[model samples]
Target chain A: MATLTELTPKLAPMEPVPFVVRSIRDELSDTFTLELDPPDGVFEFLPGQFTMLYVFGIGEVPISVSGDPAQPSTLVQTIRGVGAVTYALRQVRPGDVVGVRGPFGTEWPLAEADGHDIVFVAGGIGLAPLRPAIYSVLANRQRYGKVVLLYGARSPSDMLFTQELLEWGGRYDVDVLITVDNADRQWRGAVGVVTKLVRRAPFDPHDTVAMVCGPEVMMRFSAQELEGRGVPQHRIHLSMERNMKCGIGLCGHCQFGGRFVCWQGPVFSYDELAPLLLVKEV
Target chain B: MPETLVLDRSGLASILSELRARDYLLVGPTIQQEAIGYGPIDSLDDLPQGWTNVQSPGASHLERRDDERLFGYVVGPHSWKKYLMPNEVVIWRGERTDTGFETVPPEPAPAYALFGVRPCEVAAIAVQDAVFMPTDRVYRERREAAFIVAVNCTQAGANCFCTSMGTGPAVGEDAVFDIAFTEVDRNGTLAYLVEAGSDDGAAVLQTVVGAEPASDADLAMLESVLQEAAASVTKTMDTDGIHDLMLANLRNGYWEDVGGRCLACTNCTMVCPTCFCNTVEDTMTLDGTTAERTRKWDSCFSIDFSYIHGGPLRMTPEARYRQWLTHKLATWFDQYGTSGCVGCGRCITWCPVGIDLTAEVAALRRVDARQGLSVPLPEVMA
Candidate 1:
């Protein structure tokens, strides 16, 4: 039998763009933000989606973009020093360089929130991603009504964006509330899990577009709190984070049941994530 | 239109030499190390002249045959994917520059000729065709331009389950291959039964061999060999309702047992010609001026393969093992419209733990058959 030589199609590029770290801001003890300048038009990323930062000798890791997508000059990533790549990235300061691939994955659907009340609920470093949604909504302040932000952290020191939280709390059009797991001597406002803070907030469940990002346990409980307040399952969105190797759907690591989180979604409504949540170890 | 011609056994070497003279790469089967494998070939002498394979339950091996026949081996460890997808293909290389970064796509292999290709491999090639040649990628460009020389199996191996997979024994001359050949032992001397499946194949055959209409006896012998091949296969898979069975058995405790023993070494995928998962790596120079993004073959079994924002979605080996097996055997049908297994049995031969897909299917079948029975005391105790 004769062999057939069929020409393959054009391949898609999954390469990482190189970026140099301009500075590493020690935002908190466990959290830091890396400011990077990738060529001229480098920082083209939405808030909820993440970039796979490559550190030579230590491998690459996915970190969410903490900066606004509107700014296309400098790429900024807020990272937790839990792994090797993040740890190496934390060591880099002004002048050290790293590689960046992506801004990969589908971003949160901000267009879907038009003419709807924006409710942002963030816990600990979960605020890193929520900051963009907050900034975007505040930038176009007149498009929606009753902007309620409910934030909770492990402790007062672990709270990110404290100044921004206070400033937003004093805004006439914004309602911001902050809580912690347990208040230390320096803490004053409230001490409880993030879910407890939701009970004290003003919410018209039908009119709200609630977005939550945090640890799985915190997000799960926060969504439950929203549900208890009669929020529609489709209206409450959560940003999901899984260990990702290739931001492309090819790698099986980020699969949540039948769905590839990288390709299908990183931000899904509770109704969408509920079935997958039933799969244990998912 | 492509022409058809027949060649004698003596003409094989001349044709090979002619192609070699033209500088066209010729690859065919040979006895490589332990088993029959595909590699670059110079003459008919390198072909597996009298070898056959046996596969069953959980093993596969090659054996010598009494007849001095060429291209006699059953499915081997190597498939056409070895050439289609090299062990490593540099998709793109980026270099640090004064401007920032530049990327260069990896060059694919040039056009070549493949000989002694089997029908099951043709089916496997079709599967790869769906994978790499469609939607996106230059995989199709390389495939469409290459030459195919296919051979029909005169004898089927004991482990030959292509019939069960609905792939072969013999393939139609009207599709897939360019040239198809059937070997015949004509009163102790070997003669080839040939047909052109494409115009290019006819053109090549016209330059290489003598023309003769295949005899009735030769046709009958070819049919009988095909019938014998169909009967020789000892392994069979009941694909009728396997997908539902696998989906139902997801939480059946058997997975946990398999997972506990699984080393997660990913040998099953690496050896499987159809598995196409890949991982990308980016690197910078010592000066940090340039960088390149490289894609490498990745296995689903690795812990890093499933990293999410916080950690791995499938943390336990049980979950990962379940994902691989279920996706290959069950969900692949939904995704690719065909069973992933080609009945080649490469995974069984390459597995460190000897985890056989056929055996796994049989076990699941047995378990399904006994669903209404009372639970065994020993099973309950365990």
Candidate 2:
């Protein structure tokens, strides 16, 4: 076995990277995004992959890369201040130093998505992990046939990357749809559950890869919706997240059924997690 | 290559004293709070002398024998895993400074030797080797530096079935014990048929025992005692088709029935020699300038163990029970190439409500027989 000293992370030294937080957009009363500079290196990541951003004295949190993979490392993380680690991350300033650990976990079914239409559905801060796919399709322009982005949130204010959503709708190559559970006055968009938009998506079931990431209920509902649409269970992908510390399989905290989410996958097909899905709470 | 040596009772004492004088933190079995626990000892007197543990259906206690010997028990609650995998380990600490945050790595402890480890316990260590000390960087450092003295078991506990598990009764060829000893009664005088499995073990034996030779009869008696002990085992588990039986029962109602009574205290996993699930946490000092990263033993019984973004994946005790059992019995073959349970019986003995795994497996087998159907689960996709 290789020594621990030899396997320590050396690709990127444990030094702080400088990033100017351009803005703190409040997607919801509790959920927000700290849009910062592209790191020194090209921060490339596939959809469903995440990065471990270290806040000084506050420890690291695994937040998904919420920007386009084609662009040079402009990191955007949507987070909820649920625990101490995240609460500390939420307090960072416009100019702060944060260390990074990943691009970890199996990214969205990229090879499996070839020659297939893509449908992306996200809920609340769950959009953070799937936004990369939305960007990938927009950047590629002609690689995919049809692309659909369906996102749902608690309210209109909870919608993330709204400006990008509007721009995506204007694109000739992609279709963008947003839904919210409740809306106050001045809100103009779909006002229902995201599953309702599944019927309106433009794509063939056999040639589509439906990606869903959100609250477990929303993801489950979206999976059922896609299954109803005749998307083979193996072709539909879902990005899963858990409370993790090591972001490596060593921690053993994020195992789904018998598979380690950090090692075997963070992105898995419905056919794979289906057995566990039926067993309740999974 | 193996080196042979003989250490009489007096010579064995000299070696123990030598190890103690060197401050190697000699850990062995001793009666602690009425239960035989493995802990640091200063001299040979602290060993489990004539008293050996008698483990039964639901209880374990020490029993006195007429003769005096260092290792007379099959196994106690203390396995080598406790020290190697540790209940709590500090990975590193980060402190906030004006310049930035600086992280300090945890210090590794001095080298130590575990003496009088039973053959089954040695087998348990080898199982842990597949985990922590695997072809990974995680536990390589700790395992490579540790030392073990394997002691042959001459008697099987009432709950012991390691012979059926293909693990023990005596140390096998591939076991990584530095030195192994098989106790033998030579001409009514007690002596150990010692063999050094490593150069370090041979050097220590040469310095202490100072014996040039031992007869083949002494070694044969050692083998005979181990064979008798293996033959005397009263408990057994047919692990051959056990994995298939468990995999078939994924949706079996027995899981829910038993899980309803489970408290989710994870006592079974905590006492299990092979359950190595853990969780990591980060904490900051009151001043908020310093933080420490620590990994602590965790169990599958907790709701947070399989938590996704919004909530736990396995919330019900029934679902959690199914996960734990299937992982230990069925999927473990896929992960580690063997059943996770070593038949140490610690889980059966230490469970608060006395959830016996042997009984559970037997019940499942009965269910399989009554149904007259085999379980058919799809091949697990990688």
Candidate 3:
């Protein structure tokens, strides 16, 4: 049990490296996207992984990587100014410094879904975490069978990456369906919950892998609708959200049942989380 | 390899002095305020001599024993976690600079010799080792530098259930103790049969002046003392199928009944040696030029412990209590490959409302049996 007598002589796991804000783009009324420049000119991360962004005098919060994996040097994070740390982060301008740690947690299993049809279901800011996965699928377009994306937002103004969604919809090999809970007279897209779009999306249920990320209730309903259609529970994946203090597995805040969301996953198969999800306050 | 020697009760001071000579801080049980707790002990006078503890649900009292014995009590309110894992630790500090912020890591921990550690506490330390060693550098550093001098219990407290937990009364075979001692009553005199389990322990034993090799009769007396201690345990918990039983009863109504009485004060988790959950707090200087990130002990009973973007996951006492117990007894096995409870009875004794986990588990099983509901085991995944 006494494996090592001395502490590992290295940087502490919680220590954050310095990163400069190269650019900040406001996506919505309260949300902004910041592109960071790492000290080494490189910051690599998977599609579903998140980074702990720390403001100088404020605290840290976990935000998912929203950029393309191929262009790993320019780290992009989309954050909603909901809390103190995030609000502080939203105020940062270009040339300011911020602390960055990780790109931690499991990635969306895009490789495993290689020869299968892929359906992406994202609600609100949930699309930011799934953007990298969409990039991976599009870059290797020939490797997959069919690609479909169903996105829902609170209102037409709340939708993210509108231009990219339009371009992807114009692609001959892809299908994109956009929906909103409330829309104005100018909005011509569907108006309903994301689950309604799940029924309209075209793909072989048996051969398709569904990746859903949204509010807990939205994901739960979307997973149910997918399962009701012929997709196996194990083939469905969902990215879970929990209060995370430590990006590593040390802090117990992100624990969901026996597994830590920071370690075992922020992304887990529907079958794996079904039992725990059924239990209230779990 | 194992070696046994005999030392009179008077020679215990030599062991303390030898450890201090090696620059290892000695921590042992002592009388503080009104109860016993582990603290710095420089000499034999600091020990809780002739003291015995009486423990019950929600109550604990210390009284004088008939004879003057240093290791007379089974355990105290404090476990070894305070010294090893610690209550609060500053992980790193960052200072604002001209270009960017520069962070400074915390210093390494000092060497420590935990004196008078009971067998159950040793097992508790081992349990924590499995949980933290792989992922926690701070805990690993402190634990690696610790020298454990375990004491095999000669008596069991009223609330103790280590005999049922399979962790106490006698030190486990695989326990990593530098030195172990078992107090035996030889006729009218008291002696400690010292066993050295490591080279460091043997080096300290050589410095003692009045120690001698133990005879066969001495070993027999030690065996009888341990056997008596094991038989004296008044509380017992049935661990057979406990993991499956608790998992099946996640939605059990008994949790609400227990939660109605529970104050959610977090006493049980605070005293529990194996509960290693913590929360991090960032404190900034008034000038806003520097900030420090510190980790402190946290409990699942706190609603904020499970808070996320919207609100807390555990909003009710029933949910919090269920989470604590299920994680301690059932889910811990799945996560760490061992039971989290060491059965030291601190949780039962220190709980404000006297909530006994053992009794609750029994009630859960009885209700399931009466209902005759067949529960299938949950699918295990990493």
Best by lDDT: 3
Return the TM-score for each candidate structure: 0.84, 0.90, 0.96
Q: What are the per-residue Cα lDDT tens digits for candidate 2 across A115-146?
A: 77988888877788888777776666577778
Best by TM-score: 3
Choose the strongest candidate by DockQ: 3
Each model's total of backbone clashes:
48, 2, 0
lDDT of each: 0.72, 0.73, 0.87
Q: After TM-score superposition, what is the CA distance of residue A125 in candidate 2 from its true location, in Å?
A: 2.4
Q: What is the interface RMSD of candidate 1, in Å?
A: 5.4
Model 2, position B227: C-alpha lDDT score = 87
Ordered from best to worst DockQ, the candidate numbers read 3, 2, 1
Interface RMSD of each: 5.4, 6.0, 4.7
- Put down candidate 3 lDDT per residue, B121-173, tens digits, no spaces: 98898888877776677887788788889999999998899999999898888
lDDT of 1 at B71: 72
TM-score of 3: 0.96
DockQ of each: 0.32, 0.34, 0.50
Two-chain DockQ for model 3: 0.50
